[model samples]
Target: MMPLVHSLSADDEIFSVSVSHDGTRVAASYNDAIMIWDTHTGCRTLGPLKGHEYWVWSVAFSPDGRSLASGSSDNTIRIWDTETGTELLEPLNQHTDEVTLVLYSYAGTFLISGSDDHTVNIWDPYTGNLIGPPIDTGDRVSSVAISPDSTKIAIASFNNTLRIYDFATVSPILHDFTIHVCDAATGISIGNPFRGHTNVVTSVAFSPDCRYIASGSDDMMIILWDAVTGQICAEPLAGHSSGISAVVFTSEGSLLVSGSRDHSIKVWDVGAVIRRVELANGSNSIVTQRIDLEITSVMSLKDVVSRLTDWGCTDMSAELDWTSVGDYPISQGGFGDIYRCKLTDGHEVAVKTLRVYVDPDEQTRKSLKHAAREIYTWSKLKHPNVQPLLGLVVFREQVGMLATWEPNGNLPSYIERNRETDRCLLGAQIAEGLAYLHDLGVVHGDLKGVNVLVSKDEIAQLADFGNAVLREYTIQFSKTSTKHNISPRWTAPELFRGSKYSMEADVYALGMV
Candidate 1:
């Protein structure tokens, strides 16, 4: 489809375009500079953010949208302050050849780059320092992507092969990433990007039920994809006359929304063939200069967590106000901070805000994944001895896991206060929780008294799945590395040698506790 906005010199073509993680800003790479636009107004917000002397090869926005990173043919990488459009001082100049790609880790902690020099370099953008020696790809690198779990890096090279490197194994695999439906057992992609749009496909989203995929295009239509068959499932949604640029689904997938350059946001029911509602900026409907053309853009949901997991409307996270977080942290650990928080329902909870980091070792990554999965599953756990994860609250850039509020404090603190009472009751409560977890094939690798809470009823409830997640993810560490977060005094000696977490390991911790 022809662009609504055009430039005089078509030769100086815009090679790439990107939307910010929050979907507020749009960016495009031109011959010598990068341009930023307001996704709503379609007006230039910042740029030409000019610092590169030659063609800008790639541009990416940080996850938090605080900064912009760009690589160019000038053989250097430059970062820009998004608000002021000023180039960060002291450009990164490690590559001998032109840099082609620059991407921030999923959490915006580190910036990595690929270059024509046939090497990938990791950078701590906060300090502009290289994290380690570069990994030589032996061919000109075309693109680089970090895995969703951020434990591996994949590189597409000009030599017509893909390379994958794992942080844990320090070994590389040569071929992956072209959007194939991989078999769960054999690891082969049977499905690729299903293409059908005639003009520029502006926006794509998946339904909450995962049965349908939606695409909005400049062709002025929306198509629902049959995910199972990789074909168009329903009739095309035709309403907006101008090309569409953005599309998103509500939490339930009952409704889909699309935005277009014509300046309108059209809402459509999942199975319907027509628009249900049309909203425009400044007015309910926008009227373009073309008279017949009008449009709407997407809007941020009230809940920031919705920004990430809208498709999973039943997700563990719910919107929480920043004010709910207490002024002081109850405790802090290597990977997160805990706070006493008040939920919107007017109840207290223990909140752990995960520590966001970059270039983490395999152990740290495993811990994060394990903890996250447990947090996701904790909502389904029902037992008096096991603390129920109330839900999740993510707002203002802070993510927290909220759980049962134990006013009586932790078990260790309770034991210290009530030195005279026998601790057998609390031990039994912990044992019950362990029994429940064991039945589910879960190992509560760390079972110190510190990880147990005393409820208001003076009953003990197991708390802190921080180590529980580590066991689930199974951290991979070198044989010589002994330093860890596991409580050595409470831990079984066999665990120090990397013994698989089993019922016996937990029983040992329980016996000691």
Candidate 2:
């Protein structure tokens, strides 16, 4: 409720402000110059570090707190030595129009800039040389942000859309609007866009941990987003009375600072916002406790059932008796074997059982936990294009997941047989299913043609949730799964670099399918 920490006034309309990594100093863009102020004393420490020919629009501090970067209407980016108050290099003159935003990657490996020329460019902050070809967004860019891992770049434009690009390849992978979290390496949209803003988003910053994104909008509001799930983390912070020009989180990510066109800068307590949300929802602690239990305790079948029930899987009590039709499994999956089975109701189903080891080692426990997670995620979904979770069955002393059996089998086999099938319609259906999952904050981490089943009606139903994850859960839950074993053919480039399985990664896989 009382999140504000400081309110520093400036003499002129402030365009952008960046806080030092140590939170000791702040840099503000004023007219054609940049000024540095002591965050605690509100006294000018350095600057009027003047080199720009026109209005300076953006400023950023390097990760080490020794360098500053500024972009201006002069169509250039300037890196300044923070200690000496001197220019570090020749102006970075790559853009053809006013530079709108400047940002440094969390590791200070590279600097990114957005310009009114409708382009986003990457620069080697040390040498003042362009790292790659500029990415064309086809609209005047408003802001740019680099993910903490430095594999992705997010570009916001006047067109009201955010485009994500792979930092390594410099190729666009996803485009959407109203603020979005994207895969830095594949440019695939991570999840549904953050949609609370009523006007153009002016700036965005990713927390140092990459768990949250803070966005500032012309509507004079700031929204904190759960970067993993694309859910608003807290109620909108609405102290600014005019359009917000910039927003950034301190290196520790415990504080957020914002600059407004009203010539005022505000600092906010990021922890307070999170604590407030936790108090309102009463679920954050519950999720933490559940994650702790899964990681620290070797769970029994009864424990798994109890956890599932707590997550709203009451249907586990359904009295449907089922048995495998043959002595062998029809197919093998990542964590289990799939068998064709018949229910007591005379309905056919596919049953997947985890390959539980009798010795119950740590890996075995993790595999069981993943199975429970898959069941919990799938049970909550109810879309026509998404495969339905029927119930659970015990097979050979192991718990198995049951789902409606598709007569037509997986997509590839169905497509091979029905060559004349409407491929476009199937793709649309698959997209719809993925979109539905994303809307519910789920990531179908291992999306591929084989994971999609086709029914007698030729409807594409997404299945195989062994690799699926609910984004609302902590990242540790997803890390426990065998994500590394996912086929590289459909995996996003970022995931290979050790990034978490994300909605953007799922989108990349969807494109592959």
Candidate 3:
């Protein structure tokens, strides 16, 4: 496809380019300077705003298009007034190494930056104050982007991983090179990572509507991702002859502009691309469901609890005292929080409650049903390598599952404590637990080091059945309902290709563990 508007030539190599929210102005950064151009006439409206001591790697426009932010190899970030071509405030110099990328939140409330210093920093654009401590990514940061809602931040780094973190809590949730979607609030990875690029991913951007993600790679291709299902929306967008340096969707999301090392900028008509992909697939519609907004299961909280009781699982809600439960959760996950609590019988247990922040009515229902399904599956297991489900309790007006609290914590923490511990035995115990689950026709869909807990006896036990399902009866439910609960780094390759979780996939995850 031909670019809708390609009208800029630079004597120097362009490191990055950004389009204003109004889609009228374009900002390009190169060799210690920034320039602004009129989109239609290709006229340079603003020139060579030069103050940086070294190469400027990134430039971005605020939502209002009145200000521009640039990051440079000088290890500084500067804000520039778009109209007067003057530097705003002081140089924001928190990074210790070259600043690679800078981006403003969709609301223009704060600015985010990534650097070769291996940190991602959040700053207030107006006051130029650092928001919090810098996030230590442990690898040189390459590119950074904030989601449309401004709740999550996605950082691509030199370590070949793209990680998503909650903007409010600064918790790293999703981690993988293949592009995984995550729940911003609960830090749970949603579905599999979108995988198609054959080379390193260079940049990623989310649409204004938060429905799609566009990623550019060294493979000279741009892939659009369905934000809800973590699926590739269309075929690879191929036009740039050299590696793509940057990509951005216009404020309205109708046009996508890409910059390349080929010294060219190409604007793609996104609507036309979608239309062509749909026609090629012989379908009028591309998206079948919005997983976040829709509920696919018919089971309700009442039905789930009734099924659990019918199956002879203990319901501790009536017998347990809710006052003994901890007032705050010790840890949090996508579906809920984990709290250490004590039973009236003097035994200690970990209580996990559903943590739903949005769409309380529908989400609570779905979460309750999911929790109940987990309880049902967990109650069927009785193995030494698996954590046993003691019972179900109602606390804080939410249903929580109870299990024996392992003092040694998860596998990662356990290994951190005992560096000389035998990992082979831990791996074997994990395999034993997984084999037990598969023998009973259950697929532990999500498995990772974090999901493996170390008991006081120094034994590895499998926990967290939020994604487990009975193979014969729930093939479809496992494929669709809990699809978002997967951890991409530990996920089997076939799951990324749309295969349902099976015993073979479980074995593959065991290998990853």
Candidate 4:
């Protein structure tokens, strides 16, 4: 096959580059200006944008091709009205230091820019207004990209960490990655630094569909990242004999063009290059290095709260309880006491105070079992509707299980109060809970209404897994309670036979409900 066609030049060292969505116009940033040129004509320049005070580091065209944004060492981002050749608004002036890069998200609704100030700022391009809180990176944020679907933001920083943040909150969805690291750090050295050109990262651009991010470096390498996981997916694009100046994804999404200090423009068939690296060596070279965060896979709030409960962690909002509140003192379960304690932070936590002062000989075995059964299980479960185990609270004779509080009470209470209305809904919720547990390869051997909690929304969650067992894994249930809706009327036939419970058994009980 013909190698992807690219051109070369030895003239002005290009600092930054971007292509219009139609693949017709190309813009390059140099010393103090941006040069707009026609790709097909190979013309010297269509126009020169001359407003930056210092070196312009990056430039990007708006999705609709009507506007252009440039970031500069002057500590400002400028939005120019492309059609009118007039400055559209005052420079977006929030960076504490030089603005390093500017990019229009795929939708053109927001402009994201990174700076030498160790921050990434977001702007509403239409009104030239700051949109959300500036993301604090704690180190120079080298590059930023809003994913194609616009749900994620990837920020590569000088700390050698790639932080994946949720677009909605700008909170870290995933953190502490080593995709593009500063050479100063001590870890596994990425052999020869993608051609050994020495410098920090300077630019990052996502593929047209946002599947990959192309990051340019002062080191002269262009590394492509799997946008989904924030991991490196290709070997360093190393044609540039000097520091790579800019990296851009073509509008057609098939090629990535990079400009370098060596004065050459290289076009790459992204598919061939990435596929070779991905399938080479039997596994992706960067799979382990890339941290992929599946935003769309996030569970609902209910699942989040539920997981906290299952893990014995309290919600950040629960009321703090110093003294026990109910008519009954905190009751003890198989592993610990379920104290209804309010956290100092006002969140209700199911403090499972471990039975203190256990016999020494039994401690090791019991601790091992508890670690495997409770802590490990809680840590792995991530779903919105599932209760999350926030953390452990330890006391003299007890370990507290701080999880979310289900205010509406358990399934039995809701069933007794709501009767007909709650029955079908609660039944469905119980089924869902069972399905979730099974999906995670768990079987709540003691599945029943009393072992289930009902949220205010009437959603049912399977609880009290003290007697739960992993399907096909032999761990006997120490003890269990039968109360309210889990009485003989709701008990499955297998329970009477002392048969080990399975998801099918949970379904049998759910059907009873």
Candidate 5:
């Protein structure tokens, strides 16, 4: 489609563009700078943001429209307050190499960035904290997109793989799709990745409804697949002059926009032939976009229980108005501060606010994923001995996990206050919980006293799965606990050796009771 008016100079080679959520401002990356344009004011350049030392590769506006994030070849991502033009963060210095792409999740609660270092990092745009640990792709990532609802993230990499991760589990649900299809009814299968992409897959996108995912490869073809069934549709989108560089579904979902080395953009008529009734106009409405132009662009966790090492934040408590809970000082640690608060529904919860001190880019990402996993795991374990998960509040700059507020405090404190016999019973309860987890194929990777919570009923409940793994637990029992209650003394010699111990190992450790 031709522009009504040239928003960018033809010779400037605009690499990426993102319109503000309000549609009032537009930011485009070109070479080493990011240029902002007043969309309603005839696309005039408002000013140039010369913050990056190298080519600015990607740009995004925060959900509130208060800030901007730019990724550059300088191997950093910078956060800027849009209103005052002040840098909120010094170049985000986690990526070891060039920052190739960056984007904001639909809610504007998180930023996802991909780097030439073959890693994808998610960050808190506001505090510049790492959301979770860096996701190692083992190949340079070219593009990244979070699903509209922000529940699933799709990453394309030089390894010729498309990785799909669950926003909750923070674990990969799908990987390396090569032309494959399973029958929806009979469950039949066909095709292979090697046959479909003669070269490499370069771009991918989810349909607005997220029912389908479309991928374009260096083979000059666009393949649409059933997102749920993984079956190829009726036809491959053909017409690109050369290898495709990028592909995206129009906002309206009426067409596909693709760019290629053929030096032109091509608009494909995907839904054009479908019939539609226009109720507003009381007639049949037909819509289509002509794609023939091509251009290019590119794109955890756990917890510990050490109250002394933890630091609290006023900002998070202020956001939730938990000050009424009294003068409880929240402290920071591997996770953020732990706060006790009441939800709007009158439910009491223990909320953990994740923070940043230095450059938290990497740590922030890991924390988010860790929080997500904890929520997922806790939600599934319906045992009374397991701490209940209430919900979570996640934003671009911060993330907090909410859980059942046990006023009785942690197991270590409870054990400290009670008799040795009571401690022995508590240890048995923990063992029972561990035995249950093993029955369900879950392994609490870091078993410690702080991870256990004591309820008002005097029941010992297992908490904290930040370092837990779903696979078999094989670490040597020597892994000490952060809280000096049971980990170091109760841990077994075999665990410290990192041998292939079984559920019996946890039982043996618990026998110290």
Candidate 6:
């Protein structure tokens, strides 16, 4: 029978309304009962599908358009098959308080409910069994959403702060760079590693003005790591088409810049990227938004060199002097290939290049980008004890980053060459550098006597961040073993079990040094 619009709207006040994905049906909650209508005909199609003991407050249609979910003041939630208007099951009773909102994931694989009970629970709509642990909202949860990727959830609560959780379960994550928190007082571990990156972390840098950390990896993706929780702050940034070699924030900290083996430098608006990440992380039902603020510019290596030159980065054209080039590389462990060269200004600089056998003309630019990934991080650091970088340059035959020369060489060699002259001051300087890096939430990755170089002034500086973990374990790449790439003599025993690198591991290396 056709229901008179005037009678339906005037006599019955509706609390909520949801339209089917196909636009063929509408479900509206009215006075403890729900009415389903043929949207075009204004005729009641189904319901007063009533079983609720109290007022109905929320309603939503499943993604497939075949089911409807409802929450009510009765402290119960129900699912109704849209086709036959049949209740799917008895009301789910895990929530102790009123159910405020009900929603479905994109694939209709699960249902989510928010309640006055201060918790959010995922349910198997078909079986009514709860999935995983009930997420405590800390207060009455008003709204909740799962990210587009279904990897995270955001909850808005009465506490006035929004909380985000990773719905994805934690795994061993040995191939990924994780930030592990440990207690300063007792030297014991605190919690799980901030695990998100998909590949070995070759480089990490702190945003100058923000609470974010950036990491580059062989996976060719750049992840913005949250400094506070060691969680990923945004989606993996993807324009480079090759592994990221280096990443850094601009002087103002408003923009982030990354260089890739693709021989391109891309500038990003950090705030915009973060906001986009938040929205995409909010709900799987939401479409990912692409904004201009996220990407400002993409530049070729030639352009980057010219721009820096215009900004007074200093000319190194004359440094091509073959005689000034070192007879052999300083060493070859952490993405090795280093040569000592003199700049046109007479300043000695070390050029670190990757040894790729592919012909530049025949090689795809993508392949070259992977080769450049090892040395790009040097340009962003400026600590008195951090490796001082001059600039990055792209060459047809050789692409690389440049750093100020440390004539005193590595600590181990410097000590061996100069005899046991106490070396207390150098050790203290190395400790100071480590403190600086840890304060920024960065792990040196490859911290050894060979990676720590000393200046003529006797101050020790840290280098070779890419080697902090084993980037290329060609033979045992996937074999889970008790031994990782770290040297047994200096590494912590716990890591000997083929685990990932953490800040604590770096500290352990420092002790051995």
Model 5 sits at a Cα RMSD from the real structure of 24.1
lDDT of 3 at 190: 74
lDDT of 6: 0.62
Model 2, residue 424: C-alpha shift (Å)? 69
Candidate 3 residues lying further than 4 Å off, grouped into runs, are 131-137, 143-177, 183-195, 225-236, 278-513
Model 1 lDDT at residue 512: 87
Decoy 3 TM-score against native: 0.48
Which residues of candidate 6, in runs, are more than 4 Å off? 1-323, 326-330, 356-376, 419-422, 468-486
Models, CA RMSD each: 22.9, 22.5, 22.6, 17.3, 24.1, 26.9
Best by TM-score: 2
lDDT per residue for candidate 1 within 94-161, as digits (tens), equals 99998888888878888999999999999988888999899989899866767655667877687866
Q: Return the top candidate by lDDT.
A: 2
Point out the higher-scoring one by TM-score: 1 or 6: 1
lDDT of 3 by residue, 1-513 (tens): 523445476656668999998776789886888888865446788988999999999998999999999999999999999999998889999899999889899899999999999999999999899999998887998656576689788776778676777653221322334766656555566776678888877778778777778888889998887777777777788877788878888776656778777766667656455544444555332222111222335644444554667766787776565677666899877546788887788777898764422134554555544555556667756555789888875556555788988989999999999999989878877986786676555788878889899988787899986666664233122211323466788999889899887788888888988
Using all chains and alpha carbons, the TM-scores for the candidates as numbered come to 0.43, 0.49, 0.48, 0.42, 0.39, 0.36
Q: What Cα-based lDDT does every candidate model obtain? A: 0.62, 0.76, 0.74, 0.62, 0.58, 0.62
Badly placed stretches (over 4 Å) of model 2 are: 118-122, 130-139, 143-177, 180-195, 225-235, 279-513
After superposition, which runs of candidate 1 have C-alpha atoms over 4 Å from their true positions?
Answer: 1-12, 167-180, 183-187, 191-227, 233-513
Writing each residue's lDDT as its tens digit, candidate 6 over 1-513 gives 111111123124455556565444567675577777653334577877788899777788887788899999899999998888889888898999989878887677889999999999899888989999988989887656665566576776877545667542111112346644434233245556766767776555566544677777768787787766677776777765566655555443434555555534454546444434444565311122111111113534554455445544543554555567666776554353677777766778787764332333323333333323223333434454677666665533444557778888889988998896557767766776776555433566667888898876666789866543222211111111112246676677677776666678888889989
lDDT of 4 by residue, 1-513 (tens): 212435645356788788888665677777777766544334444456778899888889998988899999999999887766678988888898999879888888889999989999888998888888898888987656566676678787868576767542121111221233222222234332222224566555657565676777767777777665556675667677777777777776556777776756666656555544444643542211222221122333334334444544444333445554454446654555575767776666675543423233444334333433444465444432356566654443334445667877777777677767646555654665566566555666666666777755455666665555553332332223122123576567876787656777777777766
Answer with 1 or 5, whichever has the higher TM-score: 1
Model 5 agreement with the true structure over 115-211: per-residue lDDT tens digits: 9999999888767899889999889887675766876777768776666676321112123435444332222353333235555676666666666
Which one wins by TM-score: 1 or 3?
3
